[model samples]
Target chain A: MTGIDQTSLSRSTSLKLFGYHPVVIIVAVLLLFMPLIANDFILYQIFSWSFMLGIVALSLMFLAGYGGMVSLAQMTIAGFAGYMVAIFGVNGIASVSIGWPWWLAVPMALFLATLLGTITGALAVRTEGIYTIMITLAIAAAFFYFTNQNYAIFNGHTGINRVATPHFLGVEWRSTVPFYYLTLGFAVLCYWVTSWISRAPFGLALQGVRDNPRRMAALGFNVNAHRIAAYVYASFMASIGGILLVWGNGQISPGSVSVDVAIDNLIIAVVGGISRPIGAFIGALIYVVLRTFALDVLVAFGLDGNRFRLLIGIGFLAIVFFSPDGVIGLWNRWRNRHASVSTVRQGGAHG
Target chain B: MRRFIERHPLWSLFIIVVIFVFLWLVFATWPPGFEAIFGKKKVFLNAVLNGITLGGLYFLVASGFTLIFGLMRNVNLAHGSLYLFGGYMGFKTVAWTGSWLFSFVVAFVAAALLGIILQYLVFRRMEGQDLRQTLVTIGISIVLADLMLWIFGGDFYQIQTPDWLVGPAQMPFVTAIKSSGEAVYMTYPIVRLAIFAASVVIGLAMWLVLNRSKIGMIIRAGVDDKDMLSSMGVPIQLVFLLVFAFGAGLAGMAGVVGGTFQSISPGEDTRFLLASLVVVIVGGMGSIPGAALGALLIGLAEQLGSVYAPTYAVVLTFLIMVVVLAIRPQGLLAR
Candidate 1:
């Protein structure tokens, strides 16, 4: 073999053993063994909530990162799916439910959620930048109001409760271990899909559209169509996360899709790293952990637990002000600095 | 005929009025036994009056939004927070001083000071970047909202109106003709009329400033072309700062006015913000007249929708926005 071929083969082998990276194995092992070490609260509250919210943020990240469209309607779409589940599937409360099986209801909810997102995308695609934000925000506000007022389908302010999770083959999915694994599996699948799509031809085209829509259009790509398609994919992911969220909470209310929660989704994506897929997960983990513990930290200081949002808001502001690229960007910068410093030290030693 | 109609849009307005009259007549005579959901003609007139007052307040809030947004291309999502903050401050001032005028002035100055601080601290750092501006403003809004909630507590607060504007005013000209041909008069709150008057004065002052003053010219020019205006040696940044302060102060003043009639609550900040957005969107983003018209339309739609379909009152504004956007994306009076 040529010298180049031999070097590349060795590098590839060193990088991966048996087609699995060390990091992957470590992560897999941790995920599989996490329930063994952690209690129900940690597994359910921290991990499960983090995974679900991370999935939704990942959807926003995909659109904002790849498609350059920052949609505030993501939570609205997710809420719609949750509402769909409550309405279609058997719930403990509300006589309005259609009483459909989980198999039939889940797919239908997802499809309807996707359709709603696609319609919003199509409507908002004609606008640019701040206008897009406004339009999506308007849609979100409209959805919130509609759900809050229309007692016929949505059951008014107090949303449907006791939405049943999937149960089949003697497996109660809502249980701690099963639910944790289920959420973990979905989170992993979403992350993989996001990363895979980022490398896909369509995703590349969408990125190109994001960077320069006029140029992409000049190159014969349908910019609006690509954006709408991205919304579809993102909406599907958000729908899955929403369904998972409803199951996790055992209830879905108008509060679930409030303007604050919608804005929080954006915050999660931004604080993690808008342009990085893994950043969503990282950001969500931080947010969840902070929300869970910050109250305790505050109450200990003789402050109100409700002041948690103040801390979050301040942190968000500081993060945005100091590093607009978020935590992942900060990490990358630190790593680069370390690498450069070590290289300089090595050069000095050689001299 | 088409060319004549196109040339004179005012003629079309007249035609629209005629059509509206016809629709009213039809509604009055439809099915020969249809009863108005809004009770009698007196109630209908009262709803219309309420709508105008609400629209006037909306205009006061939205005008500032349009000015700042139009001039600087900055979307201050915290505009509503400033309003609520101002209202709370006004409420506190009234509680302390027992003077409505003092509270108004305090709210205005406080809101303006906060606006200046926001511009200097958060907005200045991320100039000309839309997404960053949005995120930063959202952050500020959250902080302000939480702080207000902590200080004001969770309860709703309303400002007490002055003694002079406390009673209802008789409206002799506004009467309902019943089937028995008896004329029934309507009376409106004097505070509502004062609010309407305030809106008119503010609107007129804004028009005069925007149209007749040199600074107004500079602001208008900046809105049209910022780089060009800056290159012409105008202090664009200073102008933007002033505009931002002025706009925020307007919101604060509106809050005081709104608080006198409507209760101030936690979520009202977002509500006013959304209202301003709808007004600006319907009225054409930066146009003063557009904001006025948009506010009126929203106010009317809201009142009418409430009278007819109380549950879907809020949806009417969204519907108007959607229809306007779909037909005229730039808004009704964009230029």
Candidate 2:
């Protein structure tokens, strides 16, 4: 934190007065008052979901973008946190839930999720880069199967339903606007933290390990330690996202932690662009919009409404195929083509 | 084998003890005390048999997976979709032609063709980039799964055993002694035994082809150094395509086998995919015998765990994986 980059700092400060300031201000104002312009359904179902999913994907973006580790267990970590919350906190299933308050349950969930993520990370870090994906994926699948099969704690396939959400300061946090802002607060916090971490010394070391592990090791950095630390950090961030997700849905199930959902998390991170923190939110927003409205759009096109998965898959394939960097890559390509230096400053800030 | 025993004497001794215990459990009658603790003989034998048969199916799927995805270093996440596709194709072939044998052929050809397309289109284009290839496979798997779901609907389809392969085949293992002092023998589904035998033959054949044949030498050289093999005048791409097609064909046949033993459905793709992943991870990627060993261990763990614990079967399999990963990250038999 003390050793700030002289070049980036100078450039950002120069841009503060002119370039990206107006756009940032406009986006901030629009997001702050989105509830007034959008309906309850859009606020609750669309935006909140995007914020929650964005937060989860941000965890992935941090590891993949900065640390050079692609973990499929991000959603699993989120689901584990959600499951812990439902198990520890108040729920309709008295046999499963111990009826603890949110304060007690939430921290317990975060700690346990981080612990699980750390263990998975330690094991995953035993191998090289590509194996991380396979190992994490296998772990995710194992968790899903275990949750689906075990009823004593996980409540089997039906899962823990009718879970209670937090309420305080004369505000029902689960209500439309309140919940939207709650998720927005979390999304912003996670994004800021992720962005901050990318510039931190540890993050720089991680990028070094990613780019050249042999050189990093020669430079006296513990490569495995860095990768595992990245997982620990990402998992803690993902735990927050998971708790918010459970609160948003008001339930936790094995279906929520299924393999497809895990893959969808990867898709969100990739489609948004893993290079920057904001890309997670952008990817999540696009995914949420597509999931919410693609049904009607499909029907309009005389296709099966259920074919949204195909659409998402094809779109994801296209992104991976043409724009491997996602939306950010496409934007950079466009800006470079047009030679628009001022507009490109925003992308440069993250790039 | 002798060198392995020489290097790890304790492990060799432990393996010998395990083999002896397994042989006794299979060939000898269990003591009353042992039966009391471990349940009845019939149930134990049935579970063991089921585990072995399941291992055969796993080996069928995983060997192909290990070959193309593991050995070839081609990331093919859509492998499970290929499995389901083969199963559906086999089911349709059986439903239309009523020849159970023909279904296997149809499924193999169908999956192999799909494999060829994937290899040519995807792997050929991006040979060395693991992450990009993985992402592409993920996308392909998602699209394929959705497409198959659209076509097959959500119903489970199990292949019917032919008349010749139907019914239980009695084994010599004693289950119990009747009041009349006549010993009862154990019996198992004949189709499963046949499938297990077939898988063993296929496994041995693959091992022979990989180890003893000229083509195997060429393939092994390619694995070590692709550039060298190409310079040596081998048709390396053709070899890769054939291997991929062959592996896919094997997975397709395994699907038919799976359909007979257990029903195949929509989510079965993910299940089998995970199973293969665990198997390869445990067995060591790209090693044939490792896949077989890993498959058998996972299958036995799963069946026995399901029988005994019922709730934590997955945990048992995952525990094995974690243990293997902790002890030998490259797998137990990785070269």
Candidate 3:
């Protein structure tokens, strides 16, 4: 809310590159041509995973930031979509897979994930604020245990392996370069949709509800409905990310949907700055980078490699302890402190 | 009780009938038809017992969670870490000294000391900020869990049962009838029953202290109005510290109990934390009796569901939480 102040937003619009920020243009161009500079491993493993995680965390950010509902079940809902895709689409496990084409399977998965998120949101809206965290956490744990133990539909711990990715328009979408572009495309689309819709009437109303539900209800808005709808929208976003996630791994497993993942997504959202959409991507990039490289980082620092989690925990603690709004908040503060002398003529894009 | 019955007559009658049926099933030996429908009486009894015993452990953990939440409005998401830490400490103590009884004291003291430090050092600085406090707890839990893992490794650890309480004890409940008409009595693990009894005693003691003691009055008053209590010359911070420590100590002892019933491992922290969350939510946050009822219902749901429908056991627990949220969002026993 503070980030959307009239001074900053109007000032941002005062300077733009033909209605788009030059920085945004530059970043887009770089990402579009990233495959030329980055290797397949970097593209597929690092960038793609970052985008997918960012999208999921973006869902969480949408709900928590605009709706004031910090639901921990977003990952579970996303995992449900991933599982739905594996079960409905072609997978190695013939017994569980329905072997539907990607066209049908993808939509089915998204719809089901949206339904799951909507149902979870409906239940979660029964409470308010922090209770949502506990309720959704319980729901997430239940979903994890259910998927982990249920062999018939979920394939238990091993999950559904060798899930066939979309091979459409004569392009292998799962390949490193192609998949990087696909994920980048989704990421850009999600970011645009989020920023665009955020100024829409629905987003305003949702933010109103977040600020004060009683006041919003008095203003003739259906509070729960807006919250639930936001969940549906966010769930759709997460479903896309989940599909990418599953496709990236070539499998969907119970381990991927564990409570740890749910918590990690929350960490990402919070660390990135739950107040903004870009924060989710930033947070996810940082988390994924640290998680991927923490072992070497720890070893380089004369510490045990297995203490990667310890480093993450300490980093998370420091982030939470110092800047509750996360890394974006820290950046905003630093920028405000140093650049306060001049009316910093800048575009709206934090990048 | 009379007021409740008169206010909700139909609900009261339904509850009475349910209780009567449950008691009948527990007390009376099943006939051939009953046995056919409900599976073997032995299996039913075992599941029921396991559920009740598990409920006892859950109550121990959740009571503190509710107490902490009820008063301080702190979610303390790291309560499960305290439990695991206590369990590890108990395991170590029992191994070093071979004294099962002394481990509880060590576990309680260790966990309570950690709780005091957290409340004083971290939580005190961020007073009245519920979300931040919860987030900090999450960070703390993550750190604690990782540290514990680094120390204890991934292997499962169960505190050694004392020799005096290591064997099964005979109970007079008839599971079946022999051809010669000799009634078969059930023999259950004595350790589980002993632990259950201990939890029951702890619960009663807590109830008595809260309801009947001077400190309890101060604590209750603080829960209602910290400013008012402080104005009234009560050391509100001290009360908060005591309550937090007590709650944490309860969770710690529960860790030992859980370690006895089921092995404690790296993942146990999350598992127990989830269980406590479910119990607290279903039972109504900040209510002790609510925690007990929620714990019992959830424990029973988990055990019976596992016995009858193994695949959907976790689903059953989830369903109970969902239903509770839907029907009584505050919880079944919330004040």
Candidate 4:
């Protein structure tokens, strides 16, 4: 191999030699050092929430980036899963209270959520572009209102509160440090799964469908079914994140499933450059960090925290208008520039 | 008869019949005696009245949406935000002036100015691009909603009703019961009546403007083929800006009237936006009368469904939309 190939191959080999990808290495290093610098409250607020959000965004990335489906129901599905866990695992009065163990409850909730997502996907996949957006939006709206009025099941608009996190291995996993690690683990697992899926045959088929759905259908692929399948899988990921999200907050509210949250998940997916799994984590980190820190910064400058949302709105608009590929695109460009410069140096040395 | 039915494609009519039968069965088996049923029916009648009022308000809001979508082919998701902004502007105007009329005027003018500026600044950049325009407008809507929340907290707000329109009006209605009972029921909100009247007037005015005027002809031409119209020496860009501003202004008026009829809250923007979308989708995109019919159908269906089948209330409008799209992808009144 040539020297350039040797360099890239050596870099790849070194990363693999350390038993992880570059993304994993970077995330691992950051996670190891983050808590040291972060306070307990900051760690819980920023790190834990970001990780949970990362999983939801990861699901959205699969739909938007790979499957080309723009769904506004990701947050609703996640929130539904959270509600299921709370209803089934904690509070038990008259609303189908099986009182299942956390293991069983979580899985059941995720499965139900996946089924719901698949239904939504089936409906949405029938349309394209703006129509798809409207159908998913309608579904999300229906869920939001359903949860609000179904007092028998979801306790009406008040929603279920005081949901205790799972006590696993004789430790309250919701404690700041434990929760941080739990979120980290979930995020990592989700990321790894997404990476595997992205490289798999199904992932390739989804990409093919997204690129040219008509052609894919002409080739005898079941486009709508594949799209629905992606939604099901993505919903499972989001539902897990939703369950973890409730655990982190120790409560589940209708506000969690509101259009704002749904739109926020969309923003995270877009901001992270909805192209890959690593992009979700990167996007989530930026969003959570900026959102958390922007409040303090705005407050310090004598602005209301509510006004911080204006800044976020501006930031989101700028990102969509300018860098539709988001932060990941910026990073890739930077990396490419460095590689090109190094190659030029290597050529000069050869001369 | 069978051949006539086949020629007419009576699927929609059949669906309507099934819905009516379902409603009849639900009412018959309702856990109340005849006397109780009468009382409940009165309540339901009140809800129907409320639904009609709400539907009129919806028509006002959705009319502008239909117009803009027809002319520009942009969904204008920010139409809802513009509505909310209009309410806020009117609220501020009310705070400024003691007169409700002045407040209404200020609200309309302020929303119109905002719409014009937005068209020039944001949408102008996104002209001819639907998806990009949608995203930008969505961002704008989110920002505007949050800004309003910041400006006016999440608390509900209502403009002060004029003395004449503040109270309920009672009209005597003679009715014979199914059983051996006779009764008269009469009750209606004057404000709701006023809203309906105003909406009809506005709708009539909009129809006239679209049909009889030279500007209306330009708008119609613009909607048909914007590129051709622009090539034909029409200032199509100016026409779009004007149409968009006019539509937004109409949405603003709808907001004030609807907000007054209902209650204006932080969430009203999104809710009304969804309702407007349902109206547009069901009515047939780009048709004023279609929006009106869609609004009335959705409003009545929503009201009845919420009372009878609460679980399906939200899905009822969408069900109609889905059926319409499946059977006639162009919608009920496709232009």
Best by TM-score: 3
Order of models, best DockQ first = 2, 3, 1, 4
Winner on DockQ between 3 and 4 is 3
Better of 1 and 3 by DockQ: 3
The predicted structure with the larger DockQ, 2 or 3, is: 2
lDDT tens per residue, model 3, A293-350? 9898888989899987788788888988888888877876677656666765332222
Query: Could you give candidate 4's per-residue lDDT for residues A121-188 as a string of tens digits?
Result: 87677677676666677667767877777777788777777776789899989788988988888898
CA-based DockQ, model 2:
0.68
- Candidate 4: tens digits of C-alpha lDDT, residues B216-242: 899988888889999999988899889
Give the winner by DockQ. 2
Docking class of 3: medium
- Candidate 2 per-residue lDDT over residues A1-351, each given as its tens digit: 012232234343544645566667788889999999999999988899999999999999888887778999999999999999999999999889899999999999999999999999899989876788889999999999999999999999999999899998999999999999999998888887777887889988888888889999999999999999999999999999999999989998999999999999999999988877878999999999999999999999898999999999999999988877789778756756565556433332221
RMSD of each: 5.3, 2.9, 2.5, 5.6
Per-candidate DockQ vs. reference: 0.44, 0.68, 0.67, 0.34
Specify the poorest-scoring 10-residue window by lDDT in model 4 chain A: A1-10
Clashing pairs in 4: none
Q: For each candidate, what TM-score against the reference? A: 0.93, 0.96, 0.97, 0.88
Residue B319, model 3, lDDT: 92
Q: List the TM-score for candidate 1's chain B.
A: 0.91
Chain A of candidate 4 gets a TM-score of 0.88
Q: What are the clashing pairs of model 3?
A: none
| Clash totals for all candidate models | 0, 0, 0, 0
Error of 3 at B61 (Å): 0.6
* Model 3 lDDT per residue over B1-335, tens place: 99999999999999999999988887798989978887998898899999999999999999999899988999999999999999999999999998888999999999999999999999988888788889899889999999999999999998888889988998878888899999899989999999999988988888888889998888788778889899999888888899999999988988889888999999898998999999989999988888888889989999999999999999999999999899999998887
In order of TM-score, best first, we have: 3, 2, 1, 4
